[model samples]
Target: MTETVLAEVLAELAELDDPKARAVNERHGDDHGVNLGKLRAVAKRLKTQQDLAVQLWQTDDTAARLLALLVCRPRAYDRGDLDLMLRQARAPKVHDWLVNYVVKKSPHAEELRRAWFADPDPVVASAGWALTTERVAKKAAGLDLVGLLDVIEAGMATAPDRLQWAMNHCLAQIGIEHPEHRTRAIAIGERLGVLRDYPTQPGCTSPFAPIWITEMVARQGAAVGRANASPGR
Candidate 1:
């Protein structure tokens, strides 16, 4: 059944392959060339097929692995399984999906995040920080906001690029969600120059920590004001 599923997925992927999309993926460091739209479509078709997902992942094809992320059972993945996936993931895009779509949704997310944070491998550490950002964004009640800020302040400047990106996001989330931390987060952003010069697309908020925090805070305030002005608020 897994082989049959894999064959169908590969056939669909081949039929949907676009040279332009493959080139773009390659340029972005995804060597296992595949069009993203087709990959997602394949995943949609194979959704919830855990055994097939594992088989696809073992193939190590970029598109297949992405499909695996969509179909694989997160509850079935233990720390060892996640570790193996992270080690096998060489592309930043792949790592991002694995963390956000797979590990973050797993029961072992917190356990893996704590362990991965201390890992020497940058990819693993990046995943840890990514999970941390999700936790902070959702306002997880037990997170030590001050300790998180301290870590960001102490290591952000010297962190690897991917880890730094996630750390900066965590800092921004803190400023956005916790009004009291807004000023400090902005100060940290200024000190570290996090994504200071990143080129943002038109009509999009800058991802620079200071700008992002300020924008998010303003948006939140506007939302609150709207809520208060409503008839039943």
Candidate 2:
């Protein structure tokens, strides 16, 4: 990939909550790699900010180094290379980006999510969150709701809290996307007892209150009834 523009880099940096880390990534992101160094120079001169660049040059945080790899030119890193980088880096921002960006788009999304589940590191856990949100939402059409529920059920058996958050995010998105699958989701929720732990919200009174699957099931049932009542009767 060609060097990203200073403006684009700045926009992405802004998403980061930490100003210093964002500034460092923006200013020195291009300086480390051979091919990317030229791009960084151009961005540096264009922005006229050398202090942050110099500081980035001196710091030795593995997170910074890992962020530089993704920001400077992600295409250059082989899939296998990310493992080595992850081993050395533990910054939350970098971990979130890897979860949100790299793993979501990689072929190993499932494995990455599983790793995040297995690892105790918050950064990795957050990446697991990202993997579940982005990948599942994007591929909702192709997923088998029954199979997915089974997987999530199995995951919840091993790690309920972590996978529960992930399931909630994914299921909510899926409910929105495939309104027809609400019944199946409600069944899954019942099987997993998601509603038991997180009781339905009181005021909404929607079937899917504490759990969205309830609302989805109600809607789907209505639709199915309508379909059944339609022609031949």
Candidate 3:
């Protein structure tokens, strides 16, 4: 029964593939060609199927794993299982979705964050930083903002592209959300000059840390102002 279900899902994914989509995804380091909307539609139809999700993930097909992530219970996997799956997920989209959709909700997220943040693999380390960024924004109770900035300043320039992007994002989050660290974060970004020249589509915010921080802070301030101005408190 499982084999048949897996085969049917594979057939569905194969049918969704498009050469044009593959070409576009290739530029972003994702090998799968299935339209994300179509894949999600399939996942919606499948709903929660941890068994089927595991089977799909085991196939090591990018599209299949994406669908698996969409349908699986995020808390079902143990720490080791999530770690192994993350290591196997080399494609950018798969890695991003797994971290954002599954690991973020997992009970083992902080444990994995501690382990993966220091992992030698740049890609895995990037996931660690990604988790740390979430903490920086939401649950920054004891995190050393200065220490994080220190690491980002020292290594981000030379880190691999993906890891550097993660660190850069953390920096921007700190500056955007914490008034005390905003000046130092902007300074680090200005001095490093990483992603300063990154190409951004028209009307999209630049990923360059200083600009991102400023734009987000401005938007936040605007939001606060609007709330304060709202009638009848």
Top-lDDT structure, candidate number: 3
Writing each residue's lDDT as its tens digit, candidate 2 over 1-233 gives: 11244335444433433555446655543222223344344444445333333232234443334334344333334556555555544443444455554555566667766676546754456456556556556755554666665655566434544345556556555555565765555555566655465544566533332256555556778998999999996
lDDT, model 2, position 117:
50
Lowest-sum lDDT 10-residue window in model 1: 31-40
- Per residue, candidate 1 scores C-alpha lDDT tens digits across 1-233 of 66886898878766776777778878777765576666777677656888887887898887778878888888888889998899899887788889988888888988998888778887788888888888888846898899999999999999988788888888999988888888999999998897899989998999898999888778888998999999976
Better of 2 and 3 by TM-score: 3
**Ten residues in sequence with the least summed lDDT for candidate 2:** 49-58
C-alpha positional error of residue 80 in candidate 1 after TM-score superposition, expressed in Å: 1.2
List runs of model 2 lying over 4 Å from the truth.
Answer: 1-70, 87-91, 105-132, 157-163, 186-233
Quote each prediction's TM-score: 0.93, 0.46, 0.99
lDDT of model 3, residue 91: 96
Q: List the residue pairs that clash in candidate 2.
A: 200-210, 201-210, 208-214, 208-215
> What lDDT score is found at residue 1 in candidate 1?
62
- CA lDDT, every prediction? 0.84, 0.50, 0.96
Q: Runs in model 3 with CA error above 4 Å?
A: none
* Candidate 1 local Cα displacement, residue 102, angstroms: 1.4
